[model samples]
Target: MAAPALSPLARIAREQDPDRFLCALFAPAERREALFALIAYNAELARARAMASRPMAALIRLQWWRDTVAEAAARPPPRHEVAGPLAMAIRAGALDPADLAAMADAREAETEELPFPTREGFHAYLRGTAGRFAIAAGRLLGAPAEALPGLEARGVAYGAAGVLRAAPALARQGRCLLPADLLAAHGLSAEAAARDPGAPAWRALARDLLDGGGLAAPPAGRLPAAWIAAALPAVLARRDARRLRRSGLAAPPRPGRPLADRLAVTWAALRRRA
Candidate 1:
């Protein structure tokens, strides 16, 4: 017999945000829908800039999400596919409205299409966006308060790798995420880096970012299996970092093999590490 069809939110997550979707599958069955809802909502926020033709339009869309999150706290969210499920997730205590709002606010930087002025600013962006998302996911999986720090560290590392992986696309969009200070140190400008992402200067900068964003693996027995599952995407992030190190930032990321990804996550989960 064939498998049942995925829910609308699940479909969105599986297609648009496969890494988080895969991690969500490791969550308890009862919590999977709520996790999917969060992933779908995040996917929507991540694409808001791309969906809008103008910077103001993208900010407007982000504002709508910020409003929706606030509204979800009091009553039903706006009627929409992802919004309704996200509000449900929020109401069910599976997600945090504050985290959702912060995620939306983080994307507001993207609309400006400006390179980060400093390394600290870049990492701050990762913390507010990916770090917060990881914390929210960990909480959903019943992770303890003590585990939040580890999750945030791993998530920031994952976010750094993600920026590297997204370099090619961002370049095509005429945006550069490389820190301005680093670019200047390497005798390159943001426009130059964006135009030639394959340049050796960019590769060196990629290495610098990766080195600074190293994953902090938790000690064995420090976390439960559920917490490990929540941070499993850090495994993939490490893998992608290795690939970029080998091939340079200019190389388009190869699609991850599903079997390999599942095995990696399973192994990490079994070891109770991220």
Candidate 2:
């Protein structure tokens, strides 16, 4: 038989945010659409800065999403492909408006086009963006309250790895997400790193961040199977970190091998560990 058609949000999730899309497939059937809607919503926010004509325009786009989430509880969301289903997820109490708003709020930093001021600031950005998303997904998947800490830790690690992976692209855009202080400590500046992402210094810097960025796996037993599914991006993060360690930041980041990702995610899910 031919495959069934994807919903609009599902198509967006699969195309733009494949890692989360893969993980969402492990969610219960009844909750999968809501998960896809949430991932599509995030993908939209992530692209807002790049899609805009200027920084101000990017901020305006983010504000529109923030307003949409804030008003979703009281009125119908704008007739947007992602927004409509996201609002439905919120209304059904499967997604949290506050968390969605925080995720959007975190992206506001991208409008500045500068490196993060401090390591704490960088981690905070990760916590607010990816961390919040994981928590929301876990809640939708019925993760217990106790799973929150592990979920947040793993999410932050995934965010850190993602920043490293996107370094080259961000450089091309005249932006750098690495902490300014750390860059300076390695005798590199944001402008310099942005100009030469392959500098040997960047390799050292990438290692420092990977070692200290809390990419360590969380305790195995703390999360349930559903929570593991929600935090599967962490598994990918670990794999990326390993590759970065082996090849250094001088190498361009490559797309994850689909079969390998599937096998790893499937193993993690079946083992009930992230």
Candidate 3:
């Protein structure tokens, strides 16, 4: 069967996750739409949390996605933009409803005031959400269970970097994803750090998390060549994490920086670094 047509959610995914979108260009031509379906579905769930003013509001929105997935499982695809194409991917065996639900459930943590109490707690959250997303994408790209441990490592690294990079924006929304213990160790409060992104303690903490938290490691072992393209975004994540360590949580570079980032991603894909 042919891949589903690109939906509006595909545009949102391209805008929201340009790195992965760029990397997806390297996937087999026919499978690219399914990849976009996965990315778009993820973007839709993430937007649910970002747009919510309260945890309950976010939960309500997330539940809609959950129920839609369930209904899609039982009968027909939901008529919504993201859900329909997502259902196409599910039927094609490129998407898993279980992983979709897990990602949505894990994202509820975004609505909480202090989502992660410890570094390990944050890692667990990343594993369930972003890490799971990576493994699913890996499977779509034809990687097996043996490849998951490495993919999970890349996922956690990329997810943690993304959280750190969004610290300022998250702070504005009165949410903090940084582990409480890390902030405490640095004698920093989320409010104070948010107000002054260049604070010494914030820099120290950022540096430690990016450098010592295993965010720098590339994926290990032999992987499907297609998986290198799928995982190449983690290389950019490492680059951004390192930059955040030095410069603190400044605004991220605009995505799809075709000249620099695409070249970098291409190089990383060739090298099979992640």
Candidate 4:
């Protein structure tokens, strides 16, 4: 007989985005599954809030996710289908409840209009959210907490780069992910920043933020190395940003990396985890 149907939560964890699911490769056994599920829940909640719908049900569901994650229980058979993997992982080892709460808090902030006034503000948001989670993941992999700040830095940098890489799509959502004031302080508007990011003023802002990301890099050869692997995408985005003058606000298209290749990366990472 066939196995029971996957719950809505499990579907979010396993079937939402194949690319995101594939990122589980970077973590060890317990944390990898747990992280995937955590991110899945987050993505589902974020998607729900992106509000492609006019119905009240969507808002109600969003509120439920907000409440559940914001108040995750200490003991559980697993709260929801989405949080179950994390629950199991937390039980196994090193899933600090604070780390989970921190992430939820960040997402809650994201649901509101952003209030970043400077590049520093952008960095703070990135670090508080993604950087913190990456640090916790590094810790779960047995890296010390002191080592986390470095990894956290890389995570914040990467989060910024990811936004830049997805700038076009983000703009489509009516969100300008770039810290515009960094550009505006030098007399650039959002339109100007996006139209020709290679302009001296635009490039200056990019250069500053790009350089700031260097502060976030991990210690050389620390803990399985793959934990720092997300750095590659950020590095690529920075290099491309230098040439972004002609492109303006347009984000580069997703690179054509194949599934088989990603699977190979996953296999290698898992082997290290083992």
Best by lDDT: 2
Q: Can you tell me which runs of candidate 1 are displaced by over 4 Å?
A: 1-4, 189-198, 213-222, 252-259
Each prediction's number of clashing residue pairs: 0, 0, 0, 6
TM-score, each model?
0.90, 0.92, 0.89, 0.68
lDDT of each: 0.78, 0.81, 0.76, 0.54
lDDT of 2 by residue, 179-266 (tens): 9889888998656655676677777777888786665546445356555678887888787677676655654535655578678877
Candidate 4 minimal-lDDT segment of 10 residues: 229-238
Which 10-residue span in candidate 1 carries the lowest summed lDDT?
213-222
- Regions of candidate 3 where Cα sits further than 4 Å from its true position: 1-9, 219-223, 252-258
Error of 2 at 203 (Å): 2.9
lDDT per residue as tens, model 4, 7-83? 46446655654443455545554455566655675566556646644425455665665555444555564555666
Task: State which candidate, 1 or 3, has the greater TM-score.
Answer: 1
The true-versus-predicted C-alpha distance at residue 77 of model 1, in Å, is: 3.2
Q: Of the pair 2 and 3, which is ahead by lDDT?
A: 2
Residue 179's C-alpha lDDT in candidate 1?
A: 73
Please state every model's RMSD to the true fold in angstroms: 2.4, 2.0, 3.3, 5.5
